[model samples]
Each structure stands twice: as C-alpha cells, then as structure tokens.
Target: MSKKKLLVYGSIILSMLFWSFSFVWVKIVYLIYNPITTVLLRLIISSILLFIIGKGIKKLQPIKKKDRMQLLLLAFFEPFLYFMGESFGLQLVSSTLGAVIVSTIPLFSPIAAYIFYREKIGIMGLVGILISILGVSVIIFNKNLNLIASPTGIALMFLAVAAAVGYSVVLKNMAAKYNPITLISYQNLLGIALFLPWFFLFDFHDFIYAKPNIKVWIALLELAIFASSLAFILFTYGINHIGITKTNIFINAIPVFTAIFAYFVLDEILTFQKMAGIFIVICGLFLSQAKLNFFRK
Candidate 1:
C-alpha cells in the first residue's frame, strides 16, 4: 500500500483506540459528574480546543447562510443527541456492552442510505444485517434467552446508533464543501450551545458544588482532548479520504479495543457470551461489506 493509504488507516485505527478508551473514561467521569454535566464539560473543552486547532491550520471554512440550518441539525444528531444517548447509556451498562451496541452503527448505515438517499443494498448486505441482528441478540440475551442488561440502557445506545447514522447521512451532503476540521469545530460549537442549557437546568448545581478529585479532572481532560477533539478529527479525515462506508468498517474494531480496555481498566468481565457475540458481530460487519466478485484476481 502507498504511504498515504497507510497514514489514513493508521489515523483511523488511532481514532478508534481513542474512542474505545472513551468508554472507560466516561465511566470514570460518571463517578464524580452526572451524565449531562460530563457531556457538557467535555464539549465545552473540546470546542475550545477544536477552535484553536482550526485557527492554527487556517482551514476553518465559514458555513454559508443557507447551510447553517443543516449544520445545526447535524450537530443535533451527533455531539448533542449522540453524546446524550451514549454517555447516559454508559451510566447504566458496562462499557464493553455499550461499545458492542455502538459498533452496530455501521451495520444499519446501508439501510439508512437506502431509505434516505434511495441507495440500493446488496443481497450480501441484507444477509449480513440479519446475522448482525442475531449477534446482537446473543449479546443481549442469556442462556435462557432472557435479557441480561438494562433495557433502557440498550435503548439509549441504539438511539446513539441512530443519531450516528443520521449524522453520516447529513455529513455526506456537506463534506465536499467543508474540511473535516471545520465541520467538527462548528458542530461541536453548536452542540455546546444546545447542551449548555440542559446542563445548567439539570446538572449545573452538582457541577458547581461537587469537588471532583484529580483523576476525575484527568478523565475529563482526556475526553476533551483525545476522544472528543482529536478522535473526531481523525475519524472525519478517514471519512474524507476514504468514503463513509469504508471509514465505518474500521469502527467495528472499537468494541474489541473497548472490551480489552474495559477488562483491564474497569475490571469488567470478558464473558464467553460477550466474546462469542463480538466475534459474530464482527463477522457480520465484514460480510456486510463483502463484494460480489472477490476471487476474480
């Protein structure tokens, strides 16, 4: 492979690693801060960091007036709704489980494309979707086929998945015009605007009164720098260099990273059922992206 290709892949992998660690970091932050406060503070820090980066690079393109509405909506789906779902969901479930659920974002993106843009899904993609659903069931259900985790948490994580798909759908329209950094910076800024009110109404008092320890502050800084700012930049660069589908394929690795980190860092159990489910989910993700003529060479 060419050097540029290698760089793109490396960036994507690093992005996933940062994101995987975010699951653990969120768990850490929740020990001291409520979900709303945690997300609000992270976005605040991230937005400022992104602004500095954008200014330093001299590539921060201004959005046209007509496109501002679409940009606002994009922010709503992502750093706003997506964070709301994932951060709160992590509060109730294991980080590993939350990562597993979030990994399914790519599985359904083709369907979202089909629905929103009239794109067609291959037969293999449909089959992969079914298999992935089965994998999800295996993860969620126990030996007795009863749900093993919090239903509300699973639902919230799915909400994050849906918001992610929506973000991609909208992003495809605007990416050609704006650079990745510009998009992320503006979206994060708008998301801060959207979430700050909720944070004040619900979480501001706790944030003001509670004395977070050093570790909590450290986790917050990592979330702002690595997960929210740098990771988004790398992931968006992947989407810009590659297409969204290919970039999304790399997202499947997040659960693996999260599982390992959660095991060591959070002492979360790596159960047989979870491992089996993760393997099946990854297989389905690969199959979903499989081409029709693979052996032609």
Candidate 2:
C-alpha cells in the first residue's frame, strides 16, 4: 500500500479504537449524569474544541448556503439520534455487547449505499460482512445460540445502527466538499442544538444537582475529545478517501477493541469464545480489503 492508503487505514483504525473506549467512558459518565446530559455536554465541549482547532489551523471551510440542510441532516442522524440510542442502550447493556451491536453498522450500510448512491460492493465484500457479523454473533450469543442481552437494549442499539447508516450516506456526499474539521465542527454544533430541548426538559435538573468526581469528568472529556471530535474527523477522512461501504467495514473492529477494553477497564469477562470471535472479525476485515481477482464480482 502507498503512504496515502496507510494513512487512511491508520486513521480509521484509530477512530475505531477511540470509539471502543467510548463505551467504557459512557458507562463511567452514566454513574452520575443521565444519557441526555452526557450527550449534550460532550457535544458542547467537542464543538468548541473542534471550532477552535479548525480556526487555529486554518482548515475550516465556510459552510455554503446550499449545504446547510445537508449538514443539518448529517448532524441529526449522528451525534443526535445516534447518541440518543447508543447512550441509553449502553445503560441497559454491557459495554462489549453494545460495541458488538454497533459493529453491525457495516452490515446494513451496503444496502443503504446501493439504494441511495448505487454503490456496489463485490461478492467478497458481502462475504466479509457476513463473516464479520457471524463473528459478532459468536461474541454475543451463549453456547445455546441464544442472545443474552436485554431486548430493549438490542432494539435501541439497532436504532443507533439505523442512524449511523443514514449518517454515512449523507456524509459520503459532504466529505468531498468539506475538510473533516469543518464537517465535524458543524456536525457537533448542530447536534448540540438538536439535543438542547431534550436535555433541558429531561436531564437539566438532574444534571445541575449531580456533581461528578474527577474521574467521571476525565472520562467525559475523553469522550468529547477523542470519540466525538477526533474519531469523527478521522472517520470523515476515511469516507472522503475510501467511499462509504469500505469505510464502514472498519466498524467491525469496534467489537474486537471494545471487548479488550471492557475486559481491562470494566472487569468484563473475556472467554475463549470472545477471543475466537475477535480472530474471525479480523480475518473478515482483511478479506474485505483484499483485491483478489477471484473475489471480485
């Protein structure tokens, strides 16, 4: 691979790593603040940080008038709707399971891409997605092949999955036009606006009364800086360089990373099944990226 390809892969992998850690971070934040409060504050902080960095580096582009609605939709699908589902869902599920569920984003993304953008993934890409999803299933299901997670949590996580697919479709069109900093700055800013009403009505009183400790504060800040700000920027960079379908395939790594993080940070158990599933996921990821002629459509 060329330097450019390596950079793109590195950015996507780093983004997945940050997001995997975010599962743990969100759990820590939930010890004090509710989901709405957590989402709102992180968006506020991330937006400010991104705006300042974007301005300082002279990388932020002015939003064109025609792009306003598209950007609005992007933010709505992502930091707003996605966070709503993910934060609440994580409260009801284990961090590893939550990440595994979210990792299914790539499974649905190709259908959305084909419908909206007519983007086609070869037969190998399809097989890779199924194999990765099966790997995710291995990590989530019991020996009896029954899922062990909360039904409500699973539904909410699927809501997040849908929102992410929508976000990817919209982002594909916009990534080419704007720098990642500008795109994500606007995304979080608009997300904050969208979340304000819910935050005020539901979480504001509780947020004011609750005092988080230094550790919780640190976790929240990490979420803002790494997961919301840097991760999205890197993810946007991937979409710009690699198209929506290929970029989203990297999401499967989140479960593998999250399982490792949860084991160390949250004291979650990592059984042999989980390790095997992780290996399968990595194999699928490599298969998806391979350029073998036999695997082409």
**219-265 per-residue lDDT for model 2 (tens digits):** 99999999999999999999899887678878877887898889899
Candidate 2 wrongly placed segments (more than 4 Å): 124-133, 143-146, 277-297
User: Per-model C-alpha lDDT, please?
Assistant: 0.89, 0.86
**Cα displacement (Å) at residue 253, model 2:** 1.9
Q: In lDDT terms, which candidate is top?
A: 1
Candidate 1: segments with Cα more than 4 A from true spot:
292-297
Clashes per candidate (backbone, < 3 Å): 0, 0
Q: List the residue pairs that clash in candidate 1.
A: none
lDDT of 2 at 57: 91
lDDT of 1 by residue, 139-251 (tens): 89988989998999999999999999999999888887798889989998999899988988999888888889999999999999999898988888888888788899988
